[model samples]
Target: MKSLVALNSNDPELYLLLRHILEAEGYDLRLLVDVEDLDHLLKVGRLHAVILDCTPDNESSLICARLKLGGQSTPVAALIPSDGNAQYMKLIKAGVDEGMLRPLAPSRLLQFLRHQPNGASADGELGVLAEGKSLRQHVLEMDLEAQRVRYNGRHFGLPPIGFRLLACFLKSPNRILSREHLIAAAWRDTACVKQRTVDIHIARLRRRLHAITGSEMIRTVRFVGYVLQPHKNTRNPGSDVFQRG
Candidate 1:
């Protein structure tokens, strides 16, 4: 399931632009223009992040106050005028998790929503992301703590590299990751492993997932890469509501 992000902005033009862009990044969004609407969404406690337009004076402070009042740890980013440092400090003191300069760039917004610090985009998060197994279901579970995967009441341990490769797939569900991308993720850039090494590891990883779950979760993309196929009925209600009524 994708994360839910609320955009509370005063600018209709910018709001419309951000809506489409964020939605494309796989977020469930709620556009809130009214204070009452923002309050309601915060109280619901389902929002993972909030994009607040600081165009109006004190609006950022009020929004941050409301989030604090609701006692939810939801992150907030204030979109302010790019002219001065005055508004920047105001938004920072108002408790916004991040601040963005106007004339928004695509990567800036993406990094803000994804909580990437130092302007680090998804491309830089390759090997760092595949260290865990947070997405598990459909009678198959990958436990990072135990370094083993469980399926059909049986436990299996993947080879060291195989585990890393599977963790990479688990981190990147539904995204087409190329063989080169997989190689970069599972192995350091020492130029030692060839592209065929990635294929071998993928084949082994698929066998592990299939042996346990009885379903192939990874799919090949001819001339491209691979993607993790999710279960038919599995959905994270916390993040995704698409599969829900």
Candidate 2:
């Protein structure tokens, strides 16, 4: 059984749009214009994520605040048009885990949901990772069958492209991986994002690794590509010093 999602939106077309984006292989979604079902599902811990399409009147922001008060850890993503800085801050204050603009990108949306703590998984649906030998590198442990990684005894996971990119690098440690190589390895016909998307995912992966190790894991090669290696405290005088972006 896929994980359930409760979607409540005031706009009919917006609700349908969200459903089309969210109701994928790993998710089962309930589309509701009213919040009673959402409230019940959330209270019972039956939903993984709630997508709120806020109206110009800010009804969904109020709903977001109410859900936060309900004390559920489930993520609430606000699907809204661009608002002023003040109104956007209000949405954040009201507890929107993610804010997405109009013309939603399903790939990005899926990435957000997959990384959420209580994400969906379908029945008998195996992990996206290939089952093989465990890739153990220091604090990193990859359970290929589970498609999950544990760092410092804390479990972690990433979106498909991120996972693929990390795996490609880990499988060939201490090697420079060009963006083109990564595109072939991590993204074949899967996503429509540009190669620069690899840079964003690499940056995210670097942050996660630094969180656990307190040092850089991946290094940018200036005009070249990237390379993943252990952070060296001391640097060679000939090599230029690299800083985090």
Candidate 3:
């Protein structure tokens, strides 16, 4: 069965509303009133998505940001009160895929569930492949099923966030990736993050890349963001980077 976790620290009434809507649709609902619970849940495995209630105190954007920083690919949907604009853009910047205001229409809610990638099996989904068993050079190859990085015929291990960030650069090679873009691509929604968090992760990635290759394959375009540059000689015979414009 598909699982959907709900994170809302302050609103029981809203929780009740979500329970009725998702349970009726046959989703296994895991209710989390506090954000800390999300940390533990994320460590276990991926979920279809996380639905967060937007409030004055606990915003969905922060939740989304932290999730991306930790490398969880689950999509996030933010529920705002039915009223004015309510800073939906903030949620987008934080890494939320879709933002809806309550009372949500049944059709729209169903559409969101149906389109989520988390429910799909691996054979039907995309994947990341590191370059051919190398960690020293800056270039990493990505495809629908694998990611590989090559350096002297050796491979380096990368965590999920590192892999996602590197893959984003491989797809865009020398182009400057602003923190906002990196966060969006890496997180796939902007209702839960801050820009500074992106910077910190980038710094960590740079260190790891340098340690392996002894050269800065990833560069910072000051006042802009980071760029990926692959080594000249190391190329995988079968992999080509895919870019989404």
After superposition, which runs of candidate 3 have C-alpha atoms over 4 Å from their true positions?
Answer: 24-26, 34-139, 145-167, 178-201, 204-216, 231-245
TM-score versus the correct structure, for each prediction: 0.45, 0.53, 0.48
lDDT of 2: 0.62
lDDT of 3 by residue, 153-238 (tens): 56664534455677677666778999888877664334444576577567767877788767777887889888877555445554
The ten-residue window of minimal lDDT in model 1 covers: 117-126
Query: For model 2, what is the alpha-carbon lDDT of residue 85?
Result: 35
Instruction: State the lDDT at 71 in candidate 2.
Output: 63
| Residue 130 displacement (Å), model 2 | 1.3
For residue 152, give model 2's deviation from the true position in Å.
4.4
Q: List the residue pairs that clash in candidate 1.
A: none
In the range 29-57, model 1's lDDT, one tens digit per residue, is: 78876668877876665776788777654
Per-residue lDDT tens digits for candidate 2, residues 62-168, read 66777766665566766655543354455565655555665667765665566554456422112343446456555566655455676657886554445677777
Q: Which of the predicted structures, 1 or 2, would earn the higher TM-score when compared with the native?
A: 2
lDDT of 1 at 144: 57
**TM-score comparison, 1 vs 3, better candidate:** 3
lDDT at 74 for candidate 3? 71
**Residue 212 of candidate 3: its Cα lDDT?**
74
Candidate 2 weakest ten by summed lDDT: 236-245
Residue pairs with colliding backbones in model 2 are none
